[model samples]
Target: MTTPDTQSCTACQDLERGREQAAAVRDRSKVTDFHVLIARHRARHPAADEAVNVMREQGPRT
Candidate 1:
């Protein structure tokens, strides 16, 4: 029930979300990527460089 254009549009949307999240993580301590929220709790906020690694390890939650 999906056309090629529909699939392409969905991919583009996902890419934008990823770019936005990357910028957010780089420039701030909070991120709202997908359902996983990353924030600076107390003084243990993750560094910008560690953001991607952290997210990869955490992955998606069911």
Candidate 2:
């Protein structure tokens, strides 16, 4: 059963993966594309997006 939490987690994981791959190849265009996608996702799910933005601002946890 795919719940909202799972769906949100998957979206976050996919975006993070895309970001890492883009960075690995130093592909500016792809990175920009991912940024666009992320923005759309944030618009669609502002609450979930807030959690992500907070984590991003705080940096990775140790």
Candidate 3:
């Protein structure tokens, strides 16, 4: 995933799905705006900058 902010345009025909996830994630945002990206990163325990950096160095998300 390229981050929620990048994917917020959404990828679904179901308006309900978009609205639900959108509404639920509204408060988990960050100052720089990479909410979904950060979320995916954290899912892999990459809250540490080094991990994120390493992942990036090797190219992330295939």
Candidate 4:
């Protein structure tokens, strides 16, 4: 049986992983905000900026 402490510890580990990945991406490319990443991707990938902006406007859900 899983204890509440174990559940909390798992949640914290998942959150830490997410944060670490975000940090790694930012450190590798120097982009933090989603919108900035979208813009950079658009420039490099030559995708539509309007489409990227729309996706970016979705906020944290992106």
Top lDDT prediction, candidate number: 2
lDDT of 4 by residue, 1-62 (tens): 43333243444445445556777767634324443544444354343445568778987883
**Clash number for each model:** 0, 0, 2, 0
lDDT of 2 by residue, 1-62 (tens): 54354365678669868978998999999989998887787566656767778889889776
TM-scores of the candidates in the order shown: 0.30, 0.58, 0.22, 0.31
Per-candidate Cα lDDT values, in order, are 0.46, 0.76, 0.47, 0.50
Ranking by lDDT: 2, 4, 3, 1
The residue ranges of model 1 lying beyond 4 angstroms of the native Cα positions read 1-8, 27-62
Q: Model 1, residue 8: what's the lDDT?
A: 38
- Candidate 2 residue 59 Cα shift, in angstroms, is 38
Q: What 10-residue stretch in candidate 2 is worst by lDDT?
A: 1-10
- Residue pairs with backbone overlap in model 2: none
Q: Write the per-residue lDDT of candidate 3 for residues 1-62, one digit (tens) a residue.
A: 64433333333223335445665777333322444554554466423456668878999556
Error of 3 at 45 (Å): 0.7
TM-score of structure candidate 3: 0.22
lDDT of 1 by residue, 1-62 (tens): 43333243444356446658777678433334432432222123334336557878889955
